[model samples]
Target: MTITTAPAGVSLRGVGRAFGDHVVLRDIDLDIAPGEVVALLGASGCGKSTLLRMVGGLDTATSGTVRVDGHDVTGIDPRCAVVFQEPRLLPWRTLAGNVALGLPRDLPRNQRDSESRQWLGEVELQGFADHRPRQVSGGMAQRTALARALARKPGVLLLDEPFAALDALTRLRMQDLVEDVQRRSGTTVILVTHDVDEALKLADRVVLLGGAPTGVSVVLDVPGDRPRDHHQPELAALRSELLAGLGVPRRTPLERETHAR
Candidate 1:
């Protein structure tokens, strides 16, 4: 639980990504401090996940720079680890075995198993380490995925809508689990999400990407600390602003009544 690994900062300067002539992102610039949590929110097809992929070196930028911890990302970055929308676990591996696969290869086999079990405990999946992916609930499997990512002790952790498929209550619980784990591990996080409230509740800053070839349209600093109440007055106001930025303006009281009629 006490992580000595130092977190890494991120810098993107004039970053752009294009698939041949069809550009998805261009001239994007943003900086994320180490140990910070940033959530990317935008309309569908706004290149939110593309931007996240660039950070993790899962995709390359067509032009400009993508740097994590002051080094350019040329390929799959060793400094980064990603957890995707689905659990994507190996069906045959036990939960601990799946997590142990990410352990540093230099570690002795006994240490690897011990470390993997520790991470599972960190994610509150302590006793479920022996369960296979199909034997656990969706949220439990997702927690195992998180444990696997954390077991790598990555400097930057990339999450691409990792909680998107869950029911409301499970989603909230997962968010809380992520906040707790990030706080303890001091890992930098970049989260790609479609839910505005989820972004506001979890991130230190919510980066809103939009435009024809998606750029940083708005960078709203979320007030308060982690584990925030999304319904707070300021968050409500910021939520409305973020919604409008995504082209989904909130309905006025009069409009709501009219629509109900």
Candidate 2:
């Protein structure tokens, strides 16, 4: 199967989204270069996912424009793929079948099957291709969901908290898997996640969304290499800063002393 080597760049120009009188996003301008991994961090209901949906062409912006690879996204772009929190796999289909759903309909059936298996293998699920979604563990189902997305060889991947439903350890493992796949495929990615540490671990830059009619409140460049150490002082410091930005309270030294008294 051929992979798309050139990832797509994304541009959001004065983007805004509203449902009737309720505004979700407002005048948000952002750019993501080809093959760059960016994480959108925010509390629930802050419109981070809405922003990602506009970029994916799954939802429209009420104002401004969203472009991928220089072309405006008026609808679902064939070059993009999206994975949501739930695996959303078909109960009746086998894992291979689910992954094959992402392939082009014009492709030969055999070729589509071949590509599906290849992607499953990429996500470390080669042996489970025949298993139904119900037969696999949650992590495995999510992996298959990821394989389904990657099989399309998308130029841009939009993930809406893909691992958010998993347990802590499983989520960490999924994060590593995604990072590895993104590194190998060079796909531009926009990940919307509420977890600060997850963003720091997976993203080259973390963009924070906050306030009413949410816009990017902070853009942080994560220092260091791939597979960042969560316990590293730099990451911890950055995590603390992000948590504070997300309204997670941190006791000051004086407060800590007072509490101890």
Best by lDDT: 1
Kindly list the per-residue Cα lDDT of model 1 for residues 148-194, writing each as its tens digit.
Answer: 88888899999999999988899999999999888888899999999
For model 2 the TM-score comes to 0.94
Clashes of 1: 0
- Model 1 spans > 4 angstroms off: 251-261
List the pairs of residues colliding in candidate 2.
none
lDDT of model 2 at position 44: 99
- Model 1 earns a TM-score of 0.95
lDDT of 2 by residue, 52-154 (tens): 8888888999999999999999999887999999999999999999999988889898887888898899889999999999999999999999998888789
Query: In candidate 2, where is summed lDDT lowest over 10 consecutive residues?
Result: 249-258
Q: Candidate 2 local accuracy as lDDT?
A: 0.90
TM-score to true structure, per model: 0.95, 0.94
The residue ranges of model 2 lying beyond 4 angstroms of the native Cα positions read 1-4, 251-261
- Residue 60 of model 1, lDDT score: 91
